[model samples]
Target: MNRTPEPMSRRPELPFHWTLVLLLALSVVLAACGASGAPSNAPAAEADQERPIKIALMAPLTGGAAAVGEPQLNFVRLAVEQFNAEHGTNIELVEGDTELDPAKATTLAQRLLADEAIYAVIGPAGSQEVAAVAPLLAAADLALVSPSATKPDLTEQGLPNVFRVVPRDDVQSATVAQFLLQRLAATRVWLIDDQSSYGVGLVDAIEAQLRAAGVAVVRESVGQDETDFSALVTRMRADQPDAVFLGTQVASQGALLARQMQEQRVQALLLGGDGLMTEDFIANAGGATEGAYVSFFAPDVTNLPSAQPVIEAYTSRHGAVGPFGPPAYTAAMVVLEAILRASAEGPLTRAAVRDAIAQTNQAESLLGIPIAFDTKGDIQNASFFLYQVQGGAFVPAR
Candidate 1:
C-alpha cells in the first residue's frame, strides 16, 4: 500500500470561457436588482395613471332653457364634488351647452369625442338633442346617461350606450292620461304640443290613450318659442275642454300659456310635463299657475330623505333644486360609480365603462327610487309624479 499511492481522484474545473459566462450572467442579475431598489424616474407612465378623469355635461346651458340646464350642471357638479371628497377620485366636468338644438348637440358630441380624456356624458337633456348625438356616442362606445331625455325610441333603438334616469314618454303619457280620466275626471281634454320631439312624443301617446278610453280629445301644436298663446287660449275657452295638457319643454311657454289662459278666462285645468316642473314655471307664470298640475319624473328632492344632504349643500350654493336637478344628480352618480368600477377591473376604456353602466343596480338613488337599467337602457319600473301648484308651491297630488 505504501508503494506508489494511486493518483488522487479530483473534480474537473469549468473551462475558463464557461466560468466567464456564468460570472457575467450573475453580475447582470445583481445589477438589475440593485437598479430596481431605486425610485423609478418614469414620470410619463406614472402621470398617465394618476391623471384626473374627465366627464362632460351636455345641457342647454344657454338660451330659453338655461334655467333648467343650469341646475342640471350644478347638481352633477355637486355629485362629482362629493364623490371626489369621499372616494379620493379626481373628476373634471366639462360643460357642453346643447341649447335645445340637436345640431348644437351633435357639435358638442363631436368635441367631446375628440377629447380622449372624456369617458362619459351626463346628458343631452332634451330628447331631440339625445337623438342627435346618440348615434355618434354609440359608435364611439361612449356611455350617455341622461337625466331627462324621455323619448321611448331613444333607448328602443338597440344602442348599447344610451341610458336615462327618467321614465319614457310612453310610460309618462299613460300616467298623464290616467290622471286626466281618474284624477281630474275630465270627459273632454285638449292636448297641445310644443312641436319639439319631447312634446310630440308625449302628446301622441296621450292622445292615443285618450281616444281609446272614450275621452274626447283635441290635438294642437305650437312652436317652442311662441310667446303669443292667445289664439290657443281663446280656442280652449270656446271648446271648453275639462283640462288643457301643455306638452311644452319651454318653461316660459308654459308660463305664457297659463297667463294667457287666465286673461282669456279659460277655466280649464292646466297640466304640463316635467320640463315645466321647475320653479321657473311658477315664478314666470305670475300667479297664473295656481291650481295647475305638472307631472315630474321624481318627487321634489327636498321631499326625499336620501336627498336631504345633497339638497342642503346644493341649495346653499346654487339656490334651489328644480325637478331636473335631482335626476341629473342620480345620472352623475350612476356614471361615476360605473367608471370607478370599470377602473377597478383594469385600465379604463369607454367600452368598459359603458358595460358597467348597463349593468348598474343601485339599491337606492338620490331620487329615493331603486335604480336599475333594463336591456333597453331605460330605468326599470319607471314612474312619474304629479304635483299641483297650490299656495305658490308644488304639492304632490293624491
Candidate 2:
C-alpha cells in the first residue's frame, strides 16, 4: 500500500481509497494472517502485480460543445480499452464533465482532485475550462494532457503540469493567417470571437499575425450564446472585407455567424480555427459553411494509414471521429506511458507520474507524429493544417 500515493492507500491487501476505520480493520486482518495463511513473498508479488490507477477525462458532455467533447471522450475511452487489452496495466478512466463552462470546469476539477485515486486528467475540452482548473490542479500536483485546448497563454503560464497534444493558438492562428494572406490574397479581414478563453486567445493571435503580415484587421467580441448575428453581419457586409475570421467553436456562435454572413450576403470567405472544424458546423450553418476554410491542429486524420484502425473502431462504436478524437487518443496514450514508466522506476505517486509525463518523448503515436514536450509543456514539432469545407465535409484546402 505504501507503493501508491499516501493519500489513497495504507493497506497492503486492499486497493487505495477506503475509510480509515475500514483500513484499520483490514490491517488487523492482514496482521493476523500467519505464514500458512499469507505467502511470505506477498510483498514482492504485490510489487510485480499491476496496480490500478485512475485517470479522468474532463470534457463538456452535456452543453454546447458536446458535439466535439463527446468524440474526445469516446476516443479517450477507446485508448483506455486498447491499453488495457494489450498491457497488464490496470488503468481506470473517470469522467469529469464541465458542460463547456469554465465555472463548471472548476467545480468538476475540485471534485476530481478530492478523489485521491485520480492522478492525471485528459481534458476539459476548452482553453477556458483548462484555465479555470489549472491553478487548482497545479496546487494538487495533478498533471493534465489537453487534447483540444489551444490557448497559447495557458502553456505560457509556466505551469509544468499543463501539457497538451494540440498545437498552441499562436501556431494555429499564424498558420491560418499566412494561408489567407498568401494563398487567398486576403487584404482586409474582419475578426469575431466569443468571450471564451479559447476564442479570445485565438483571435488575439490571429489579429497580431494578420497585422504583422500587413493585412488590415478588424476585431469584435460577442457572448457565446448570442445566436442572432444580423447586426454583426450587417456591419461585416458594410466593411466587405476579403474574409471573416471567427475564433469560436462550432456549437457556440461560430455556426450562427457563418449562417448570418450568408443570409446577409456577406461575400467574404469564412475562416476559423480547429473549433469550427466539426461536422456540426456545416450542419448547423447549412450551405453557408461551404468553401469556409478551417485551420486545424492536423490534416484529416481519417486519411492517414496510421489512423485507419482508430477511425474504424471509433466509427463502429461511437459514430464518426472528429478532429479532436485522434489527439484525445494520443493524450491518453501519453499519460499511460508516463504511468508505466513511473511505475517501473518506483511507486506510482502523482509526483512520479508528473515527472514522467514532463519528460515524455514518444517517437511515434497514432497521430503518426513524434511526441515530445518542451520546457513550457507545449508539444514539440507541432504542425497545423488548413482545411476547407467542401461538399459538406472537411477536406485539405490545397
Candidate 3:
C-alpha cells in the first residue's frame, strides 16, 4: 500500500460510546464464546477461526471530555462491526473509560495489559491520558492507535507500539498560526491554555509561532475543570486583542468561555484547536460559537464520498458527526486491518500486529486522504484543516 502524498483538491469525496450497553452485551457473548473453547487437538487455523480477537477503545467515556470520547467509542464500534461482517471473523470490541484522567488511564492500561486477548487499542483521547498509558502499553508491547492525541512527544519517545492518525501539535499549531496571521489578519492574539497536556503543549507551540512572526501575544492559563471565565473575558476586553486562541481538550469548557466572552462584550475573534470542534461546544455555546474557528488535523468526512457509507451508518444510529469520530474510525481501521494481515500469516501476536501496522498504506482513507506511517509510527505527510462554525455547523473556513 505504498503511496505518495496527494493534494487536498484531488482527494475523493470524503459517539455515544454506548459504553455500558456494549460492555454488558460483549461480556455475555465473550462468556459464551469462552465456554465453548476449542479442543486441545484442534488445528491452528481452526482454533484461530473460532477464537475471538479483541481490540480495546480507551477514551474518556464518563467525564467532562466524554462529549469527544463518546463519538470516538461509537465510531470504533462501527469500524469493528463492518470488518466482522465483511470478513466473517469474530472480532470483539471492548471499551475502557479513562474519564480524561491520567491516573484512571494508568489503571485502564494495567487492565488491558492483563487481558491477553486485546492485541491493540484505539484511543485514550486526551494527550495527557496517552502520555500516562503509553509507557505501560509500550512495556507490554501492546499496540496503541490514538485518533486525537497529537502531542509531538507521544511519538518521539521511541515507543514502537504507539501510533496516531492525526498530525502533531507542531504541525497543527503552525497551520493555525498561519491562518491567524494571514487569513484572519490577527496582529494581537491572546492565547489561553486549559492546563491539560494537550492544551499546554498546543498553546506553547502557537505562542512561539505568533511571537516569531512579531505578533503581540498575551498568554494565560486556566485549570482544566474551571468553568468561570469572567476574569479572562475582562482581560481580553481590556487588551482588545484581534483574536483569542483557546487550547482546551474539554469541549464544554470552550463553550463556557465563548459564552462568557459574549456576555462580557469582548469583540475578539475566538479560535481553538481540534479539541473544541465538537457538537457540545456548538450546542452549549448559546450561539456564541458562530464564526469561531477550529484547526483540525482531519477533514470533514461528511463531504468525502469515500466516507459516505460509514457516515450514513453512524448518523443513522447516532446523530450528526463531529471532528473526532472520523479519525477514530480511521484509527480503528488501521489496527483492525493490521490484525487481519497478521492473523492471515500465522498466529496473531502483539509483535506481529505492531509490525503490520508499521506497514500500513491506505491509498485513500475515510477522509479521502492517503494514509501511511513513517518509521516513527506517525502518519506520513499528515496535514491539518481549518473550519469555522457558521449557522451552528463547522464548515471549511475558506
Candidate 4:
C-alpha cells in the first residue's frame, strides 16, 4: 500500500454509444412490428387507433354503361389519390361493379353495408340503380353521393344519406325546352324515349315544358333494344317537326335512329340528354350528330380555378377526363372535407361524417362554389347546362 498502492484497477465503463445503438435498433424493430398489423394494432385491440377511412365506389365497370361509369370511377380514383397525396391520410377505395343493373346494384349495396369500415359510397351509375339501393343505404345508415344519378325522385324521397352532384333530369329537360323555344325557335317537336325510367321521366318533363312554352308535340315514339329505326324515322319525317328530342341512352339503337333520320332526309334538329352526349353517338351518327343539342350537368372544373390542378392531374394519369369531372372531383373533396371536419372533434364514425356532411354549408370546393346540402341531402342549387355537338365536339350552346 505504501508502495504506490498498486495503481487502482480501472473498472470498464459501458460503451454508451453501443448501448444507444442497440436501443435505437430495438425501437425501430418494435415500431416495424407494430406497423405490421400486429395484435396490438388489430381492429379490436386499440379502440382509438386511427383507421383509414374507406370509400365504396359502385359502377358498371363491364357493361353497356361501362363507357360512362368507368370514366367516372377513374376520376374518383384520381381524386382520391390526389387527396391522399396532399393530405397524409390514407383513404381506401373499394370498387364494386353493378353492371348498370338494379339487382346488381342492390347486391353491391348489401355487401358494402356489411363492411363496417366503409365510410361512404360514391355511385350506382343509373338512376334506377340508385333508386334500388337507396333503401339499403338508408337502413345501414350509410352516406351515398352520386355523380351521375340525376333522378328527381332520389332527392324527393327525402333520404337523409343520399346526395348527387348533377342536376336532376327534370331540370335538364326544362332547360332543353327553354333553349328549343327561346334560342332555337323550334315550334313543333317529336319526342322519343327508350322506355327507361331516365328516358321516360325526361321525356315527360320535356313534353310538359314544351307544352307550357306553347310548342306543339307533333309525334311521339318509344324505342326498344332493336337497332332498326326506319319506322321512327318515317314517323318523324311525316310529322315534319322542327326538332326531335331523344330521351334515350346513347345506344346502338339511338345512334341508328339518328342515322336513319338523316338518311330519310328528316331535317329536324336532334336534341338529347347527357345520356346521349357521347363520342359514340357522334361516331355512329357521323355527320348527323353535328348541330345536335344535348343537356347535361356542367363540368364545373373547366371554369373553376381550384379544379385546374385536379383536371391536370387526372388527365395526366387517366388520359381521359371523366364526365361531370368537376362534380366527381368535388364529390370526393366533399367526402374528404367532411371526414376532416368530423375528425377534428372526435373519432371518424359513419354517423358523425354523415352529420358533418349534412351540416356543411358554404364549404369551398374545386367547383369554385360554396357547397351546401338541403334538408334532403341534395345540393340546393344544382343546375344543368346545354351543349351542342359541333364538329364532333360538345361545345356550350350559344
Candidate 5:
C-alpha cells in the first residue's frame, strides 16, 4: 500500500484569471448594496410626483356684470390653456362664481383658501367684491390679482397681497376729466351716479377734478333701477351742462339714461366710465350710444404687439373680441409667472408663491410693458385712455 501512494492524484487548482473574476464579482455586488443603502434625491422625486399647481378664479359668472366678467373668465381660461399646452405642465383652474355680490365673494374666497391646493387667486371683477374678499386672502397669506377692479382704495388699503391689472379710478377719472375739459373744451359738467360703489367713486373723483380744473359742475343726479329718467334729464337740461358723466354700470340704468337723454333731445355730451365699455351698452341703448365717451383701463389690444397673438388666440377660441381681454390675460400671466418662480426650486407652496408675487418687479407682460408694484401694491405708472362710442363701438379718443 505504500507503493508510491499510487502517485497521489494531482488536484487541479483554480486559474489566476478565475480568482480575479470572482473578486470583481464581489466588488460589483458590494457597490450595488452601498448605492442602495444611501439617501436618494427623494425630495425632488416626491415633488415631481406631487399634485399639479392650482389657481382659483373668482368672478361674476352669473350676474348683471356677467357680460363683462364672462369675457374676463374666458380670457383667463384661454391663457391657462395656452400656457399648459406649451409648458408640458398642468395648471388646475378652479372657478367660483361670486355673482358680483360681496358676501358671495367672501364665501367663495374662503372656500378657495381652505383648499390648500390653490397657490393664487385671479379675481372678483368688481371693486366692491375685491373689497370684500381682500381681507380673507390677506389673512390666509394668499395672493389676489384682480383684472378689473379699479377703485383706488383697493391698493390704498395697505393690503400687501392685493393687486390689480387695471389702473385705479383716480387714473381713469383724471384722464377722462382732462379729455372732457381740455380736449373737448367743456366748460360745464353734469354728473350722475347709480349709487353703486364704482359709480359713486368714479363720479366723485371726476367731479372733483372737473371743479379743480375750473369746469362748472352744473348738476349732479343719482338714480337706480329706474326705467324713466325724464325728471333727471329735465334737471340736467335746465342746468345746460356741456357734458354729462354716466358713472354707472352698463347693465344698471345706464342704457336707459342714454336712451332717455337722446329721446328727450338732451344734447349734453355723454360720458361714462369703464362700466360702459361693453357691447351690451350699445346693444341696449342703440343709436343713443353714438358720440358717447368712456374711460377705461382697457389697452388697445390690436396695437400692442405682444398682446396681438393672445388676442388672436382668444378671438379664435370664442369667435369674438373679449372685454377686459388684455387685463385678464395679463392677470393669468402674472399668476403663471409667480407659480413658475415659486416652483422653480421645488413644489409650489402658497406662502412662497405669495411672496414671489409680492416681490415681482418690472416683469414684461402681454401689454408690451413691465409690470411692477409700488409700496401700495399698485402699478406706479398706471395710465388710462379715453374712448368714444362711434357706430356703437369703442374707438380711441385720447
Candidate 6:
C-alpha cells in the first residue's frame, strides 16, 4: 500500500531548482525594499512637501511708496499668522522689496524664481511693477496674487498664474464715470493724468466711458514729477468742468494738483482714484482737498465686521493701516488657501498652487467682498466705493 509514496515530486531536481528560484526572487524584493534611497520623484516631492513652506512678499519696503508697501507686507504677515494658528501648518515669508519700481520688480522676481524654493508672491504693489514681472511669473508658472495693481491691460494679457484682488483700472474708471454722471450730474468732465501707465490708462478708460454716456470729456496729460500745476489749473478754471478726474498718486503729484486748483480758483470738484485716499494727500493739499471726491477699489476695511480684528491687530502693531492693506490681506488669504489645497492633493509645486488659486470663490472675503477669479484672473463681482472729503477727512459718500 505504501508502495513508495510516489516520489514527493515526479522530478526531485525540478522541485529544488524551483525552491531556489523562489528564494532568490524573495531576497531580491527584500533587498530592494530595505534600501535607504528615496522612491521615484522623491527629491522633488520632499522639497515641495517640506514643513514650513516658504512664500515671498514683493513690495516697496523702501522708497517713496514704502509707506504703502510696508503696510501691505504686514497685513500679509498677519494673514499668514492667522492661517498657521488655525490650520496647524507652518509657513514662512521671504521679503523681496520691489520698491514700487518696475525694473526692481523684474529683478526681484527673477531672483525669487532662480532660487527654486519660493512658492508664491504677494505683490510688487504698483501696476507698472506687476506688468513688468508678469511675463517672468507666467513663464515660471508661479502664482502671483497682487493686492493693488489696477492696470486694465494686466488681466487682459491672459496670464493664468497672475491674480489681483482689486478691480482693474478699466472697471474702476467706468464705475467712476458712471458715478460722476448719475451722482454728481457731471456734464463736463476734465481728465488729467501723470502720463504714467496707471494714470494714462485710467484717464483713457474713463474718457471712453464718459463719452459713451453722453458726457463731455476734456483730456490732459502731465509728467509724474510735475509739481507746479498752475497752467493746468488755469485751464481748468477757464474750461469749468463740473468735475476733474486726476489719475495720479496721492503723495507723488495728486495733492499738489489739488492745492494748485484751489489757488487758481478752479471750482470743479476734484475726483480721484484710490491713490488719493491718504492723509498725506490731505496734509499736502491743506484745505484744498475739501469737497473733493475719491473712489477706492475696496470699501474701507475699518468698518467691516470680518476685518475688525485685522484692523485692530494691524493698528496695534503698525499705528495705522493703508488703503492697500485689506486687499493684501485678502490676497494672502487666497494664496494660503491655494497652497494648502495643493498640499493636500500632492506636491505643492508652483503650477499646482496656481491651479488651486484659480478656483478661489471666497464667500466672505476679509474686505467684505466675495473674492473670486474669472478666467482672466480678474476679481469677480467687484465694486467701487466713493468717498467725499468733508471737513478735511475722507468720509463714505455711499
Query: All candidates: CA RMSD in angstroms?
Result: 17.5, 8.1, 11.2, 12.3, 17.0, 16.1
Write one digit per residue (lDDT tens) for candidate 6, span 91-135. 877777877989988987876775455678898798889889989
Candidate with the larger TM-score of 2 and 4: 4
Candidate 4 local lDDT, 1-398, one digit each (tens) = 46654444665655743543454465466456567866554554363464446888888888887877777777888878888888887888877789999998997787677566678888777789989998889877788888778777788887788887667777787788888888879888888888887788888888988888788896455656667778778877888899888878754555677788889999988888877776787778777788887777765355457667777777777775645556666777777777778889787788888888787775576666677888877776766777778887877776
Candidate 6 matches the true fold with a TM-score of 0.79
Those runs of model 1 whose alpha carbons end farther than 4 Å from true positions after fitting are 1-48, 98-104, 192-201, 218-242, 248-268, 275-288
- TM-score attained by model 1: 0.74
Best by TM-score: 6
lDDT of each: 0.87, 0.82, 0.87, 0.76, 0.78, 0.82
Residue 378 miss distance in model 3 (angstroms):
2.1
Q: Estimate each model's TM-score.
A: 0.74, 0.74, 0.73, 0.77, 0.76, 0.79
- In model 6, the number of clashes is 0
Clashes of 1: 0
Candidate 3 residues 1-398, lDDT tens each? Answer: 68988999886542333544454466567556656764543654565566668899998888798888999989999999998999887889878889999998898788777666789998889888888898899888898999998778888988898899998878998898989999878899999998887799899989999999999999999998998899879988899999999999898888999999999899999999988877888999989989999888888889788789999999999998887899999999999999999989987888899889989988978867888999888898877898899999889877
Model 6: residue 161 alpha-carbon error in angstroms: 0.8
lDDT of 5 by residue, 130-237 (tens): 999998899988999998898788888877789887788888888888888778899988888888877888888888888898888864556566678888898877
Runs of candidate 4 exceeding 4 Å displacement: 1-46, 195-197, 225-240, 250-267, 298-306, 324-326, 362-370
- Score candidate 2 by lDDT: 0.82
Better of 2 and 3 by lDDT: 3
5 or 6, which is superior by TM-score? 6
Lowest lDDT block of 10, candidate 3: 13-22
Worst 10 residues of 2 by lDDT: 14-23
After TM-score superposition, what is the CA distance of residue 140 in candidate 1 from its true location, in Å?
Answer: 2.5
